[model samples]
Target chain A: MTDTTARIPKLTRKGQATRDRILQAAVELIAERGVVGTSTEDVRKAARVSGSQIYHYFDSKQALIRAVITRQADAEPVPGRPMMGALDCFDALRAWADAAIQRQEENGCRGECSLGSLAGELGAADEDSRQDLSNGFLRWQGLLEQSLRAMRDRGDLRPDADLGELSLALLTALQGGTLLTQTMRDIRPLRAALNAALSYIHSFAADQR
Target chain B: MTDTTARIPKLTRKGQATRDRILQAAVELIAERGVVGTSTEDVRKAARVSGSQIYHYFDSKQALIRAVITRQADAEPVPGRPMMGALDCFDALRAWADAAIQRQEENGCRGECSLGSLAGELGAADEDSRQDLSNGFLRWQGLLEQSLRAMRDRGDLRPDADLGELSLALLTALQGGTLLTQTMRDIRPLRAALNAALSYIHSFAADQR
Candidate 1:
């Protein structure tokens, strides 16, 4: 976050609004039409910014895209969200799953995961985007791992369980679930995937029974 | 398969070879460049087909893309492969998981799922491509469900096991694993994802133990 803020020059309120406007426009259009399908002219017209205003703020489309990525990555975690904050507990795990699933449900299963959608589309061919997505996913997984580690430390999870692996598995399931949900236009796939993953994690919960 | 075969005209051996050549070229270029990135002229040049020849085979880039999707879908399952043929058994599941992981490994984690890759970029905006992807994923899931149902018939799995949901979960995990593997350029993500999912399925096995 600091890195992003530091990179951008100091701007007046109007300049900042213009930049925000451009990014917001990019987000909506790029999400729908994809990066290739959207052009600078479309962004400029949508944002009501002159061509020079765009160039002054963003040297190129790629720069603007990176900014959009940064914006999305930064906004992933909902502020003041208890569920995401307490994934270490089994109940919180369910809540986290609920939050994840409800996110898609709210969007009507559209663009299940914005960063994931971008990574799937462009990660295969573009090194920069791949790196961005890899970092983005790792950061997400890291949050899960941190909570799992907390669970382990608190004697809620098995000591021998591999937290890193478990976190990655959970993430994998979520991504798969969200993708299926969006494609099939059905919520069941995501629900099943998350449920299975949470069940697996609970399997390591010190065998409470 | 019958649907695809019926679309092409009855052709001589030479014509079949030409069609195969075009599809092969399209696969390579389109997988790497994506639909919007690769052009008809690029495919025409890559396939070494003249302008007239390109038009003779496909009406437009979209038609060629659909053909490519069909070709990839047809080749997804290994002919007479036990692992894919019998996803219900433990050994076969391992083999299938290995195959899925190894595919991405072989490509250095590039475009782990080509159909998925294309769908992510175009599916939300393009109805035809979305339908193609949805069908492709369903067919893949159907193969798993068929094997699971067979396993249940043989008492390999509990009758109460929701085979439909389980198959969906497995496919979801596989897709997630492959996507993470591709993005992170790592194998552990895929390994962990598939293992977790399979373990969940095994938990539903009739407890012979």
Candidate 2:
């Protein structure tokens, strides 16, 4: 949070709106065509702003992309997934998986700009973007850990269950499932992936005897 | 197979060598950068071939990328993964997972060009590329399915187990796990993902009664 806050330049309300417009345009463009495909000039035109205006908010393309990563991270786009927060129970986790699969199906399995996709594109070559993506995933993992810890406290999960590994597995299923869904143009991979992860979690369920 | 065969232009042995050089260069560049970042000129320079030579082999950048995808598919780069084949039993599956994690660890978790990464970059926007990627994953899935079927035939797994879903689940864990490993710069995610999928499969183990 401090890092993100410190990077933002002071701006009046109007300036903030202009910056948002530029950022939104960049996000859409980057989603459609990755970071390498999106140009500042393209963002400028998409935002309906002048070249100087884009420069006013972001000093360079790297800065703009970093800003996008920061925004995506802060937004908690993938794992938390907007309305699907507080995954503290097995039922909640199952619902989350269903929602993700349904959403992908609704979109015809077209891959969108999620943190995972961004990481897939940027994680290899760019060190800074990799760090940003790492942080984003860590934050998501923290949320899942909190939920698993809650389940453990509630005696829904076994006391000895490995919460960290469980959370990481769920996340891995998600990132991988979504990738396959995009590539295969089908929802079954995502469904199978999530079902396997969920069943794995269920394997660790408390005996309740 | 017929589609790929029809697309290849007839070439002399030297012409084939030149084409191979160009394709290899493009693969390296695309792996390091991405499909968008690697331009025709870059391929020309990297391959040490003239622009006319590149055009003689690949009529367009799209054609070159498609060729790469087809090559990657036929090679079965992700699931078969070069040396690891016939993942028909529990031991082979565990060994494959360990090797994957070790390989990622050796590379410092730098994401390499795999079918997954290429699909992540090109799957959404390009229909032709998306079809190519879809075929690649389907081929890998077929290999996994065959392995799982062998296990079933061997009475290692329950006859009731859904081999297709099981195979898809394993593939999802792999693709998702690899993506997370690349982003987080850690092998733990991959380890957990593979472990969970393996556990899921183990859950369906024969009663041995």
Candidate 3:
């Protein structure tokens, strides 16, 4: 068995809870202060763990960041719906956008977006972080692509439309809009941008009909 | 006159050079270590300035950051090409993109984009910085809109296409692609994304008779 599996077998319920708490604290702190700004001490205080305990759980700060990225990837909503691959229409896509915006607002744009922050900071720092971030983005793009392909297959979109290109466009629009909204601390620009892009999506459907 | 303008009038040539040195050092450090990670001591060492001299030029770290932002913005490429805005063609647009990418690459994506970094970091912390960033983006977008309008008038692009929307789309794509490119430390993805976007733009061009 791998080291991870070996460790997993030894982790008690309490140990598991402590690990979860550490990961949660890391996420929140990294989001608020950014990767470079947040120190190990800050994570310790946030998690209410001692310094030794933190090191015990993870070998280094980079390892902790890796864990956070993994957690974020696991948390991503399945394409087309909250549950796995259920909804598959324009409305489903719209609903997903709405939920995403609401979640960002609730967070007050304080936390660096996990994937974006990781991509921005560590992806360039080291090979491991680069691969981690790239994989995360690929998975994200994959999720979106899955949804687009489903919509296309169902005749909700033009069959001839390039699904890969459309998926990239959608992800780019969403990400770009989020960056603007976060910096401006206003939802209007994001709403306008998304609405404009969605209108384009609608046009594709209309043309098909 | 504002306090800054009033004080600037009294600076000796030597003092001006010193100030320039400080700003240059701050920009380099910020690019290397990021805004939050860089320290006043680091700036002083990089500039070969004593702590007292550093303080003489700027009151605080925040002040130093603001100066760097102003200087970087001033140094950015002039918005309109020469000859009474006569440079209006696909070649001109491509030239602009090439210049932008070159400048960004030279800096190694070190600090957040000067404007983007300020907008992301201080846009919420201070009103003046917010205005500076917001105005910078607005001006950038305005320049693009003007170019798009010219292209439309020349029968290069579809007359019915929304210039404002298209301008925003182009700017957002460039910004988003830069962010990803810098973080990944690989320009290949950015090249792919940009090419895809440009192809889309080309598809909107007026067809030959």
Candidate 4:
């Protein structure tokens, strides 16, 4: 999102792996303590990498954060979680919601959606980060829209359904519900928000035979 | 919420006014920056108060932050913002949603819900702050539920409607929508989320004669 490709240095496979390991550590730290609370030193220690190693991979903390945002935008890059991308049918959408709630429950509702949390902290704090985050959100919305549009094309939803609004509504519910879930330490808010959004989507479902 | 009354020192009317002034300044700083970014020194300079004067009212920076959270919970205490209370009817709920969107538009979607932004930053970071924020959210949700329950008793909503879930849905929409609005710098996500939630609520409205 930040034209980081031009600045990215070519790396050997080992170097790439090391870079990913550092990025993963940074993501975890950022998840535990927000962007402001996390530092490159912390990431280095967590990654068990040397200072030079981190510097070799990332030019600055802001650049590293941008890379993290790009990683988050790529997909649900978190290793164990189910991919939240597919939404070709109603059941897939429902499964996506259930998986989100289950993941929160599994974590004891301690953390939030990584990208959403970063957006919350960095959205207004930095200009470059804001653009990166805006792109992340749009990419996410685009995924949902893609799926919803496919559903409409397949005659699963009404021809008149507005894919953009519906996708944005779903994304907002997830973002809002996840934020509340983090605070309340309860999964119900997330559950209710997603349920409401799903029902709204269903309201546009083509009448069944 | 913290049993702070016993520890609170008695203040003269003047002292109370001064404390409010400091708090107002702190809120502005926190809204602009964040909890992690705003420091006591910043608040002191912003409020034009001496260090001792700030300490006289708030024991520490964390104490001051807790006070800010308290103020946010006291019914949308931000100056000049429309009171987001009195949701005893559908139109009032719609007005609340519109006011939230209008405020975001006015501010160019820079800041999030004050309580929500605090929750975003503090929810997982500090246990005490998490408790304080959980109470803030519950209090806000309670107000919404109070109004929805009133509507139910008056037969405006169906007797079978789950007021708690409905109210939670509405709050989730606001929190989610507001967070997205802050990131996307657009009002449609907030508007769409609230509209969808309101439509869900209206689906439960009592049948017309």
Write candidate 2's Cα lDDT for B77-134 as tens digits.
5344423338778887787777777878888876677888888777766889888889
State how far residue A16 of model 2 sits from its true place (Å): 2.7
- Taking the tens digit of each residue's C-alpha lDDT, what string does model 4 give over A1-209? 43444466687789878988998898889888877778999999999999999998887999899999888877562324334556789998888888888888898987743878887777656878878888888888887899898889899999999888899889989888888888888998999899899988998999754
Give the per-residue lDDT digits (tens) of candidate 1, residues B1-209: 33364677777788777888888888888767767678889988998999898888888888888887777666663333565546667678777877777777777876633666766767666777777777878887888899888888888899899998899888888888878888888988888899898998888888656
Query: Candidate 2: where is the Cα deviation over 4 Å?
Result: A1-6, A78-85, B1-10, B78-85
Task: Give the runs in model 4 whose Cα sits over 4 Å from its true position.
Answer: A1-7, A77-83, B1-9, B77-85
The CAPRI class of candidate 2 is medium
lDDT of 4 at B106: 90
Candidate 4 lDDT tens digits, B1-209 = 44343456686788877988998899898888777778899999999999899998888998998888877876462324334446778887777788877878899988843888888777767788888888988988887888888788888999999988898898999888888888888888888899889988887899744
Of candidate 3 chain B, the 10-residue stretch with the lowest lDDT total is: B78-87
lDDT of 3: 0.63
TM-score of 1: 0.93
Collision count for each candidate, in order: 0, 1, 2, 1
lDDT of 3 at A86: 34
Q: Report the Cα lDDT for residue A198, model 4.
A: 92
DockQ for every prediction shown: 0.75, 0.71, 0.26, 0.72
**Which residue pairs in candidate 3 collide?**
A31-A111, A31-A112
Off by over 4 Å in 1: A1-3, A77-80, A83-85, B1-3, B77-80
Q: What shift in Å separates residue B104 of candidate 1 from its native position after superposition?
A: 2.1
lDDT of 2 by residue, A92-201 (tens): 88878888888888888777778888887777678898888889888878877888888888989999999999999998898889888887879999999999999999
